[model samples]
Target: MPRLSGCAFFSDKIMQAKVDLLHTGAEAMFADLGHFSKKAIQIAFLSSIYPSLVLTYAGQTAYLINNVNDFSDGFYKFIPRPVYWPMFVIATLAAIVASQSLISATFSVIKQSVVLDYFPRVKVVHTSHQKEGEVYSPEINYILMVLCVGVILGFGGGKEIGNAFGVVVIMVMLITTIMLTLVMIIIWRTPPVFVGMFFIPFVIMEGSYVSAVFTKIPEGGWLPFAVSMILALIMFVWYYGRQRKIEYEMANKITMERLGQLLAMPEVQRVPGLCFFYSNIQDGLTPILGHYIKNMSSLHTVTIFVTLRYLLVSKVDQRERVLIKRLGPRGVYQCTVQYGYADNLSLKGGDDLVAQVMRCLKRHIAMSTDRRSSVSTEEEIANLEAASLAGVVHVRGKMRFYVGDDAGCFDKVMLRSYEFLHSICRSALPALGMPLQQRVEIGMLYKV
Candidate 1:
């Protein structure tokens, strides 16, 4: 009786450790929510996936019970001899489809991370014209492929890989549970008792699995932990550096009055055409424009300070996409183009952007109450039309950031790493479809 009790305890622990790996599909489905509607995922899972999984697990358990002595490769061996090969082929295809879904979800997550300034910029290819969430990242795909190959080579067996996967999946579930609890309390405004009702059981269940899997860390579970730490460090450094850079820009930003004074200088020349100055700032003039004025001493007839901002929503209406505000200086306008995560600003051949800008300018002119007279509005519209005819010039900044002399060792290392990542990653120009000949890159270096 004592020996049977001990065996049962050992079997329970083994089952707890391996159960997370089985539920990995559930976590993966959540990750893929961006690619599909919430209703679609919920219905598919409840109606089809849940039933199928329950039946499959029941069949496997029954087979294991009948053949208790045959423990080695029980899953595959349980299948009937006639349909074994066909089932194997189907399982392989299903795995490939699941992998593809996970890959797509990864791309969507990375793109969101970039927008939120938590990661360095990377080339994101929108795979579908209509579905903005369907994206592919060549660089990330290659990185994932290399890492998968490395893991296969390092582990060299299914058991070890399964152990690592189980550890990571359980950790992810625990984190999700914690996040959901916070959301319930803070965002959903649920009562403490209700929150505890959902939280306590999950914490206890997942916490036990966490302890069970910790024993497997030395066996093969350390791989995911190491990889996760490295990625977290990268994200931390990128986010910190980006915040510092933004602070520096805000502190040194050129105001409209300062820009007006610069343009009024005797050496300054007002040339024909429209100049689109790209900036991260939404209101004030960018340091890049100040640099340009100081060096070239030239200004366009009509200048538009352009900033692209991504909102938290999935889509922004086309009618409300472009926002134009006239600045203190004549012919100076702030053009903000707003987009949502799942919104695409298709600037095919760059003509779409130019046309949109022209339309917004005309609308602003018509709506301005401060215009002295109808003649002034007409003159402004004519000037914009003439500038459009003269051609549009896109002025972009090529910026480099360096750490300050008084920075700590950690700050130096992080900033240096961020600089390296920035140097290699793709910029925003290519994605905008800006013409090469019309694009002008002004170089600026900042010590922050």
Candidate 2:
């Protein structure tokens, strides 16, 4: 697939700044939470609750019917009470909670763009904040409360309300799964092969389970499935077109040798280190050097920044992070460096980017050097200090979308994208994926 630059954005200002270990706010947050342990806890909690609730609801109607049949037919006929009503109620509640939470979380996931300014500004309250007795969504809360009161008075209980819950739950799960896939690809920089092999399959399987339930349920169960399918179709078309549009916009900037040269210039010149380059590409192909260079130049070095989110799966090709590709007289392609959307640091939660880049670049260069070696720590420090004082360079350009309207969306997308490229330039070698070049340092040009 051809990659596209969303727009044209470039700058030529350079700042000699220090580089540090902490790359972005999210990284800092993950670090502060002590990393894996916090994530493990979250995964564990979600795993425990999600499947249990889904399964509990799936067989509920069947259990209700079997128990009702066991009771005397005359007893139910005379008073008309189902033996499994209680179980049915409990199962319905469980499903609603799980599915409702899923829907709310979908909103949160999309809201990240809003937080990142990829979308228009809107207020969103964190659920935890509301749980602590804060009036977060006053309008929504009051509307729900009043409707619930109306239902109680009208039906004596939630019989009518309960009937509609199953359909709502199923619709939400399907929609959420679809949304999750899009988010993973667009924002998280998830590889298409991995997403297709592992993630999409799981979603299809879960959807099948939900589908079976809808097929078997007695009270308008199929309604939810129909709605989910309709919504899914609409979203699929919208998202697919959007992606195609973005790619078309970014096409001119996705050159292989050009990007490789951009990465090499700062390091090869050794002109005080910090350098920042920006591009208006949505895919961050510039951020991901391995994929970009491999296709363009056929020079494979250890791709220190290979997308590692799917390392375990087998069918997917496993290229080492550090693949050494020869450039003949140009010398070995020391580091096949590419930076993309995910690597962009400018979108990080409010950070002093210039200072952060300075610190990060210094640390990156230092991490490679051994103090006990010939170079004294004092001298290395002096060099780093001098580099920072020299200031980094910034390159900016006006990216014109090769396709579609020139609304601000194109510029907004590209500017943020370029900023991200700058951020990656500011930071150290990426920590995940294929190993990066040990012999060469990808210098950052820091700018404020």
Candidate 3:
């Protein structure tokens, strides 16, 4: 079971030594030891094959002889040359094979970690992997298959396809460098002084080299530009749509105050007490977590609560801000931290944020003035009652018993505040399937 944030110090003391032992043992057995030697050997074998073929085909024997002949005949007297343009072609093939192997291996490691939730997901696998830990990729394999077939079909007929591959790849690298620099400024929050010192100079140098390469080889530019444009369009549509959906979800959730109140409940206090719960407010509170918390019957000393803000915006400034407060036993201090990003951000490796929160809970409570509006207090209750003379039940705050299917305690708590939700839906819609003002009507229920 996950330990509560407050008492985790004790748990950590007891478990740290064991955890260290396991980590050291795993490294020795799996990372440093010869357990993965077989895989390495396979990688080496594949890397070596094409390079050997390319070298051999290039007439290494004749090339050496020609060099010697040139030196002996006083350079200018060297007239005859053995044809080996085929070697250039072979070398290109060899380079492509080598690049693919390396790319596949890197992505394979990434893919395993991502699917298992050991790390944040990225576009590591363009295709499939056969085994859980295998480095082979189906995407790479298919791409290779297509290239090989193309090579066979266009053999000696169209070298442009082969030539285009290298040129386009270089163009991609240049574009990537530009994108990386921009990302560092926007996402990394790197200081402008350092960014200018490093970024401006590096861009100047790299951009010049990239421009020179493209100018020297114009065909490379057009093809890569076309492909890049297509990819940019796809990404824009995908990311923009996703951001809108996430925003819609967060806006409809309970206020930050109620969330903090929920964390203070007796049932919520038993589990390794989480101070804050960050989710895509639309996901609301997870029913499973709520059920476990409600069932836990222990008391914990320290806690910090959170509700994460995951938003994808074109600009980072559009991100949400955090709200923090101290609730003080049975209702100690609590905080909410919010952040925005233009892309998906991972929580791993971000340090012990909850620990920092625990300290804030003990000493301070910094939240927005707007928080009171979101949370329902005694005044809100009277207003709610006045608005509902149709005998609508008005439940508010920690004392309220949320009514919903035991969808789990967390979700139930969230749904309870939405009591007017179902009524509103019934009054607004004529039929379940019928259109509702150009809107896609979801159920009043919020499921995590």
Candidate 4:
């Protein structure tokens, strides 16, 4: 039961993952196309095909004199040699296509999880410049390859893998049903009676699949559980440690007066071009900015502290996605970009983030009535254009953990585990879609 406890991962692990409305709709449309297309095919022609296939299978089962139990053998017995061979070939092609779809879905789902911050940063390479969605993750790919090799070694045949796959498919369906019921009662406010009407049959159907596959745990069914548990452990540990770090940052951040002093300091000279100080913190400057001004000894002409947050809804309106607030007169701004779990970030399709930030800041400047009326619209645009020509840079703080000097034994152990897990997690740079040359990463060590 403890090992099987990984069943919880199917839902809980994906809780942080965003499911955008457009992607959801596309998936649903394709699902419907598959479902009704099959239904239509059955109704129009497969009705006859089904009866014949059933008879063929039944006849093979009935024949005690049957030389073989294999489907190809069965087909050879019932159908013409040439026709049976082609049928087998066609079936194989169909299976490969189906498997390709599954593989593609796996990549997309994991990428989505990374976006939603469920997983740590991983290398995501766009395989096609023209096709925005065509991406490849080497880390996930290698992990999958190893797992598949292990599965082939353990299962020894496609039939065993397929049997386990059937169990997983049913389990996912059951989980989807359970989640749907909750969504109905909560989000959609469906009546209890209607919820019961929708889920009862599925519960029975999927529960039967559970029974069928539960016994096969010893027969390679435990593969997914093992894999999921390992993945879930890595995911949760990274997320928990990162959350703790952010909490630390929030609790110990510089006060408003202190931040004002730092920004207005004589050493904080405004250089040409723009700088993006990326942080999860919404209030008070991230400690890294303090480090930057002290160590780097200067600030950008335009410094916008950008924080990306996930909103509760499915998608934020394009106009409302980026919220801009000018913090002080030191060319500092706070830009919080909100994205729904299911919504794509504004930086999608190779959009220039620096340009977007400038636009948001311009909009803010235009709306503010308290600003001096001396600077006209043309001048404001010219300043932005000048900065755009000067180029842009992204700055992020990378934190490492150490046990606190006054820490207890438990704290030391916990900090050790945290650092170990954190080390294995992906770096933020690759995930942020920032070019290596333009990105500046500042390191900070936290005694936890």
Top-lDDT structure, candidate number: 1
Position 121, candidate 2: lDDT: 27
| lDDT (tens digit, per residue) of candidate 1 on 317-354 | 87888998888777888999887756656556444877
lDDT of each: 0.83, 0.39, 0.40, 0.66
Worst 10 contiguous positions by lDDT, candidate 3: 391-400
Residue 29 shift from truth in candidate 3, angstroms: 26
Q: Which order, best to worst by lDDT? A: 1, 4, 3, 2
- Model 4 score (lDDT): 0.66
- TM-score per prediction, in order, is 0.90, 0.31, 0.33, 0.69
Instruction: Report per-prediction Cα RMSD to one decimal.
Output: 3.1, 20.2, 22.3, 9.4
For all candidates, the clash counts are 0, 66, 17, 4
- Runs off by more than 4 Å, candidate 2: 1-164, 167-234, 245-251, 254-275, 278-357, 363-448
Q: State the local distance difference test value for candidate 2.
A: 0.39
Query: What's the lDDT for residue 130 in model 2?
Result: 16
Candidate 3, superposed: residue stretches over 4 Å from native: 1-99, 102-158, 172-209, 215-221, 254-448
> RMSD in Å for candidate 3, one decimal?
22.3
On TM-score, who's better, 1 or 3?
1
**Candidate 2 vs. true structure, TM-score:** 0.31
Error of 4 at 396 (Å): 1.7
